[model samples]
Target chain A: MSFDTKENTPGTVPANGHSDTTPEARPLLIAIAGNPNAGKTTLFNALTGLRQKVANYPGVTVERKEGNWKFDPGRPAARLIDLPGLYSLDATSLDERLAREVLTGRLPGLPKPDLIIAVVDATNLERNLYLVTQLIEYNIPVVIALTMVDLAEKRDLKIDVEKLRSMLRIPVVRVRTREKTGLSEITEAVRGVILEEREADAFWIGNAGIDASQQADEIHLSLSDDEAANRQIFARYKFISDVYQASVGTFDTERANFSEKIDKILTHRFFGLLILIAILLLVFQTIFTWAALPMDLLDQGFGALGETARASMPEGILTDLVVDGIIAGVGGVLVFLPQILLLFLFISILEDTGYMARAAFLLDKLMSRVGLHGKAFLPLMSSFACAIPGIMATRTIENKRDRLATILIAPFMSCSARLPVYALMIAAFFAGQTVFGFISVGAVLMLAMYSLGIAVAIAVAFLLKKTILKSPPPPFVMELPPYRIPNLRTVIQNMLTRAWLFLKRAGTVILAISIILWALMYFPRSQAPVADESTAARVQLENSFAGRLGQTIEPVISPLGYDWKIGVAIIASFAAREVLVSTLSIIYNVGEEENEESPTLIGAIRGAHDSGGAKVWTPLTALSLMVFFVLAMQCMSTLAVVRRETNSWGWPIFMFVYMTVIAYAAAFATFQGGKLLGFS
Target chain B: MEKIKVLTLADVAAGTKAKVLRVSGSGPVPKRLMEMGIVPGVWIRVVKSAPFGDPIEVRLRGYSLAMRRNEAESIEVTE
Candidate 1:
């Protein structure tokens, strides 16, 4: 069968040598389909073994991951598509639509799957079978891989595989994916179906060729249940029952899902909230603790590299660009990679363990009070890592208004990139001040920034609820999957995949942006060098493009106590938040040096002064800077993601403008207000 | 009838039936409620309320529905 090139729009390109056309000549198209949390992903990962492409579905935002695997011992290989985890063929969510589209050959560029590998959670058979029975109607070659058998067995449930096979007339393979027990058999069964099967008459393929438009219509029409709709549903259920009994086996057991037990305690009203708070606190603490060593190492390593470059090269513009501009600007941001990865690692753990949903359950009531949904909580929580993924995660929120609101407020959460800037300022300006000798100034400043973020998010959400994109609250209908102990293998794999994505972006987007900034600050040399290293660097920078640009814009930001240096840092940081610290470092000429002798960016800021000998970074200025960073749209990646997520530049542009204005105003207030209160 | 505020199904006593009067919020509320088979004509009965009145289990349209207390508030009901 020839694959329609236009149909596969989600950016999934097959890794195999076969051309886009004529997929039939290459390998069998096998789709692994099942209910969410049914071990489908595990089975796909095991079968494919690393040959996979993660992409999006065309015309929709659902993630599509496809791979190739040799299921049978003698079979060459089968192209496997791991469709989204869907509860039913009746697509409600965007992800479900893509899964259904791929299965039905409606999704462009993707060949209609030749065979269906239905991965069922053996423990939740009856519920999972609802979809499997629907797939059998498609008359495609089908193999049932029973997963989570270990959990089923523990719950005292036993499935008669032979009986089920006879009932369905399809090959049945039982496998425990996490334990890696039934992989070989699953592959063998798939091989048997592909190699040993007769060419099924495509024309006579049961009800499998049901009209797609009609199905979509039916799904749309079944939105409500009056007595009539209720009867219609019962009729559908009857049809399901006939197919279900004909194709599935019987299992009886008191399966007490561990997740349910944990939910009872953990999702308990009081305990659930407490646990959530404690978890967030722990994550915050761990992010600081775990990232410190690697951060220091990266800091020192970059500093040394810069020093080496400076020592080796003759003092010229090229040398200045390499040591002062590039290393200073980019190295500053790169040091935070450890913290970002750790933050994602924690998020991945929660997601894999399925506690994230529970956290949503606990927080939904509190969040909904402010017009946010429970589903929005995960994405908002993820913003603490980075707003780009957090904004992308809004796809989980099905309602358009809810998703938009969530995206709008996500950046307001204190992301890790903002942490370095906060830390530098707090350490520099608020070193030893104590509130009644109980709370340190650093601690208070940190609390204030975090609190400001939350407050701003709430206010914006409230305004959005009342004004733009106004809507009644979306119905909250999230499935609480039976809790399973997170498979460490899967968690680690997912974390690596996500971290790799971040690093890739860092190497590409951040790298390009850093180079451009370096070039901008290296050109248009000053007439002559000044006495001190810092003064010489500053004068030369002011003559450069970035420096000149900053000078032009300095007047607008002067009220907030910022000079051209801070203005340039703000502009550079717009590419990514962590760049703020590094841009400032570069502007201060904190190039490569020995770790012990090299001054930290924090130290440089403490000692900085303008031409008049007045301190450049005072307590008031530091506080104003922190407030600006807290409210500003400093991450271009996040803006780009918002564009993709919203499918418009309008919202992202609006977000950027509104946030910058807020940041500028807040900083102005803090600085001028602090001065009025005699803090300066 | 006092048009008893549609408390979360958890807050309602077991076996008590109530009519959905109106949903409190705007936008996507209808789609959400409709997805749950909670159309205006349907009468729902509280089957069980979890501790702390959250994710209260209710029976309607021949299926068991569990909703958080906040979700329940969106569905204005009359006893």
Candidate 2:
């Protein structure tokens, strides 16, 4: 039967020598669906490289990835949407629901796809076809893009493409994205089907004329006890087994495959644990060694840019605001870009190579102890670099409560931004001192602080899962996909897409927050000017809104052994935790120092006095401040990302209040408890 | 007539083969397990357990799937 062009969206011309175009041409919608780790991503990238846009589905954290592709030369392009990987058409998860909505043309702004490409992993034929069985029911022209045929054939499983095509009543194109094979064949098949729909009904499924997805749920709800579903499942498999047995030849008792051989060593109980730790160490080292130089260069580049703007521009509020507020805000955003890109590079590589699942498998038990999924391991590990990327990485986790709990406790990993704060506090007081007569006290304290963050994170995750964010332990049915050498092109493409999303979604919020923070510290310009510039800065900070607010909270912080000046520093650090050092420098009237390693900043901290000529600096106070930074939610960019990820302000607000209270109580305990132990 | 032994999938050791008799749970766990193609009369082989020993891997329908022992208990099998 010929396809009806009238029912399709008007004005979208099919360029296959048959044009019924009117006015403007809107692209036809095509969709690609498959199971996770089935090489669906590779095929989609191969078809639509660099032409894709990744965005979150409206008001949901699930990503909606779409790209434009022309089926053949001189043909009109179609918008190809890569749906989330799913096991079935049933709407048990949000991803599945979204896929159904789009499939049924029920989702707003997205029409039903004019064509469907089922990316089937040839090695896993039976289960993959289970989805294909449901796809043909939609009455859309369906084509199979069979992937990994080479791997399947290597296992002595021979597949006849023509027989498969005939049995399934659809076109089957064996495509290997790496070799660039079968791309045009698949395209031609698609073009042919789009022009002329499949006339013969799929005889295997008795009622193939009706859409099963729409009825499957209704039937499932009404039938109630699994009989209908089991029957349907068996019927589909019965049909599948016939096609499989006819079109494929299997050599039984084949020797262990390459994946099994590799897993023999990689997943060994003792060796697997050691290798995992080694890989983690490698990741840790890469962050410190490779990302360090780029981070430093970005830091210096932004600092120099800010200085040049201040030097060349005229003295006014606009100059200060642009240089201090806007430029610095943008700097804070891009400074983390290197870390985010690096984190995703590793994550994408691990995930593509399929080792991430093994990592998850190995660590699943330890993570579950804290009420988290095994996949939460990487996100929490990468949070030590920065929570922005870590929070974004939680997309791998499917359970809502587990994902939120992971996001909430990620910042407690003591990110790199907290390093400068720790450096200054340690150098000023604990420098050159030895704990237990041999170990450097500063080093011990640093390790203790990191340990403290880890301890607090585990506790928080446990508490959250037991309390409000509680849910049943998600069923652990994971497929160990065959490992492949990571494709650099795909890894980099995914990395860049994630990095761009971070800039657009989280960057703008950080810019706005920085301006407000600047205004808080910049407003009510003291009409009276002082002779000394440094003294003028100190005086101005004391009168600014932030200064007064910090003073108002001085009594609350006093129990934590902090004065109003320290309170102001704490407030300034909200935008960026590293700003604590620079804020202390300005308040102490030291030079404009940003680096915590600067000797003058530490020296100033060592010999500062309050209004009563009492020593404002004490060793116990430094320890308390370090404890506070370990738990406090100080970074605004993290909160911005949290708000976006949770799709609500409520979670972020709750996160902030809980973290601050915990920080306060911990700091109070440290200061008050240390006094009892006579450690001052 | 001799009594036949009924064993859960978890009792199947690594490298052992078994035929799935039935999936016996009514919770979402069994529903999901079935949705992923673990049904009655399928021949499945126990692959291996993870380093932690709770979630064990099984090869069925030519692909390896990992699930916890608790969920695996729902699948009644006979060697």
For every prediction, compared with the true complex, DockQ reads 0.16, 0.62
Question: Candidate 2 docking: what grade?
Answer: medium
Instruction: Choose the strongest candidate by lDDT.
Output: 2
Show where candidate 1 strays beyond 4 Å.
A1-24, A53-62, A198-233, A239-257, A304-330, A529-534, A585-615, B1-79
Q: Write the per-residue lDDT of candidate 2 for residues A334-398, one digit (tens) a residue.
A: 87678778877888898899898888888888888889988898899879878887898887676
i-RMSD of model 2 (Å, 1 decimal): 2.0
Whole-model lDDT for model 2 versus the true structure?
0.81
**Number of the top-ranking candidate, with TM-score as the measure:** 2
Best by DockQ: 2
lDDT of 1 by residue, A1-680 (tens): 10122122222323221335554466778899997788888988888888888766776656677887866655567788988787666545677767777876767887777788899877666556656655665556678899877767676656677877765567789897877788888777767666655332221111133443353345446643233223322333444344444544332322234655566677666777788899998997998899989999998888899889999999887887777667765676678778877877888788877778777767776677778887898888878877766776787776788889999999999988888788777777787899988889888889999999999999999898889978776566655666667877678776766666556545566666667777777777677958887677667776889888898999999999999899988887787776666667667777423222234766788888999999888988989998999999887767766777788999999999999898888999999999999988
Window of ten residues with lowest summed lDDT in model 1 chain A: A1-10
Tell me the spans in candidate 2 whose CA falls farther than 4 Å from its real position: A1-25, A197-225, A251-254, A434-439, B1-3
